[model samples]
Target chain A: SQTIHQWPATLVQPVGSPLSLECTVEGTSNPNLYWYRQAAGRGLQLLFYSVGIGQISSEVPQNLSASRPQDRQFILSSKKLLLSDSGFYLCAWSVKRGQPQHFGDGTRLSIL
Target chain B: AQSVTQLDSHISVSEGTPVLLRCNYSSSYSPSLFWYVQHPNKGLQLLLKYTSAATLVKGINGFEAEFKKSETSFHLTKPSAHMSDAAEYFCVVSPIYNDMRFGAGTRLTVKP
Candidate 1:
């Protein structure tokens, strides 16, 4: 069974602070990883996705960026956070393209 | 390109009543569709997925959805609503590998 892990379960950050959220998958190899953000009263917006190590595609232009350092390790980071960056961030993994994605327990980020 | 639309932003249903959450999608090619549920401040969980095999797909927790290519719809339903079913639901569409789109989620409220 594949499992995705994300942390910290919740985060509170000040404006202009740095942000880094990590995601890793177990029991799978070369999986596709994705980063998504869900705002209040809105659906999820894909921020980034990675096919392989050091390869990332940005779905929407935003202050956040993603990286894949290992085959199953993905990281979402920002140099400086904005108030608009506050949201529930999710990490997902899929065995292949166009397949069902498995999600991790999201990180609720609040910016003050 | 692929896009998804969830018919209603919010739906309220009484316990023991049938549940219907409508979803429609568009794609250049045969698309893959999925439904996911999100509890308050939690990550999205896969409810069901349509991959061109079965028209009617059964998922976890007594949830099911029928894929209608003629209507470009994949509507989710349950015979009886449970309070635990109250959550945000998302409709997703994918035309190709790594190109997934999400609908503005539908919030399901099951009343006792």
Candidate 2:
């Protein structure tokens, strides 16, 4: 069975602070990875997706960026955090494109 | 372009009553539809998915959804609501690979 792990299940940061969230999948290789943000009372917004290492497609223009360092390791980063950046961030992986994605527990980020 | 619409932003149902969460989608081609459930501050768990194979799909936790091509709708239903079923549900549409759209989500509130 495949499992996704996300670190820092909850985070609190001050404005202008750096942000880093990591996601890793076990038991699968060369899977599609995705980053999503869910604001309060809103649906999830896809921030970025990667098909392979060093290949990322951004869906929204924002302060956040994503990187795929390894076949199953993905990272979401920001040089500076904004108040609007506070939300629940999720990491998901799928065996192939157009397939059902499996998600991690998510990171709740609170910016002050 | 592909889009998904969840009919109700919030739905309240008494325990033991039937549950219905309506969803509509728009796609240029034959689309893949999915329903995901999220608990408070948790990751998304896929409830069901509809490919071209089955119009009626059964999912985990006694949940089921019907896909109607003529109506462009994929509506989720359950015979009896349970307290554990109270959560947010999202409808998703994928027209092609790497192109997935999510609905605003419908919050299901099950009352004891």
Candidate 3:
């Protein structure tokens, strides 16, 4: 069985502070990784996706960026956070392009 | 390009009643579709996916969806609604599996 893990589960960050959310997948190799933001009306916005290590694609231009440091380890980071950056951030992994994605518990980030 | 649309922003249903969440998609060619559920402040869970095999796909928790090519729709339905079924549901479309587009999401509320 494949499992995706994300942390810190919940986060409270001050404005202009740095942000880093980690997501790792187990029981799979060379999986596609994705980062999404869930907002009230905007729905689930795809922020970034990676096909392999050191490869990331930005779906929406925003204050966030993503990185695939390892085969199964993805990281979402920001040098400086903004108030608009507050939302539920979810990480997902899929075996390939046509497969259903498995998601992690997500990190609820609140910008103070 | 591909996109998804969830018909209802919110729906209220009584327990044990039939549940239907409408979803429609647009794409240039054959695309993959998926239905996902998310609890409050939680990550999205894959309920089912349509990858061109079967028209009717069954998923976990007694949930299922039918893919209608003539209608360009992939609507999710449950025989009986449960209290646990109350959550946010998303319809996703992928032209190449890696290109994911999410809907605005339909929030299902099951009343006692």
Candidate 4:
């Protein structure tokens, strides 16, 4: 019985502003964490993934970066936001590689 | 490396009718496949997965998919479509020790 929590479900930020989104999972230990973005009318794009604390992998290099400071805590942050950064951001967790991932409710970020 | 292709970008089906969404994948070895559904502005929900076990996998909401090795296909189907079933569907392929590859996604529209 694991659940993921994502904060700031809806965010509106001005251009060049900083951004920070948090995601944490409960009832799971040492799970793989992932960050994904979904643009309007498009599929998801993997931004980053972490197998363990302080072990982050970038799937698609972009303005966004992710950090796994704790075993079940992941944070996505950006020093300055761009217009292209506006999208539905999702955080997912999986028991391990080649396993099904459970997704959080996601955060709708709109850059003004 | 693993790649997934969702055959149709959008599909319209009448209520109570059979529903079908086609998907194809490419991988060097036996890959893990999954189907997920997402409502508008919502996170993904795992429908089913194929991990070289059962050829036919049943998922929630009365949806199921069959894995075809020769064709490298995993097509999703439902006996009867419901209005609530209208959403976007995704096909994903996860190779061993690699990041998961997602398809372009196929949007299923259920008409009354």
Off by over 4 Å in 3: none
Model 4 scores a TM of 0.98
**Candidate 2: segments with Cα more than 4 A from true spot:** none
DockQ list for all candidates: 0.79, 0.81, 0.74, 0.80
Candidate 2 vs 3: which has more lDDT: 2
* Candidate 4: tens digits of C-alpha lDDT, residues B10-106: 9999999999999999998999999999998789999999989989999999999999999999999999999999999999999987778889999
Interface RMSD of each: 1.2, 1.1, 1.5, 0.9
Rank the models by DockQ, top first: 2, 4, 1, 3
Model 4, span A18-104: residue lDDT tens: 999999999989999999999999999999999999999998878888999999999999999999999999999999977888999
Q: Runs in model 4 with CA error above 4 Å?
A: none
| Candidate 1 residue-wise lDDT, A38-66, digit = tens | 88888888899888999999989988989
lDDT by residue (A43-102, candidate 2, tens digit) is 999999999999999999999999998999999999999999999999999988889999
TM-score of A-chain in each prediction? 0.98, 0.99, 0.96, 0.99
In angstroms, the error of model 1 at A68 is 1.5
Model 1, range B1-112, lDDT digits (tens) per residue? 6789899999999999999999989887788899999999888899988888999999999999999989988999999999999999999997766556889989999998
True contacts kept of 3: 0.77
TM-score of 1: 0.96
What is the Å distance of residue B18 in model 2 from its true position?
0.1
- In candidate 3, the residue pairs with backbone N, CA or C atoms under 3 Å apart (3 or more residues apart, or in different chains) clash, namely A97-B97
lDDT of 2 by residue, B2-94 (tens): 899999999999999999999999988789999999999899999999999979999999999999999999999999999999999999998
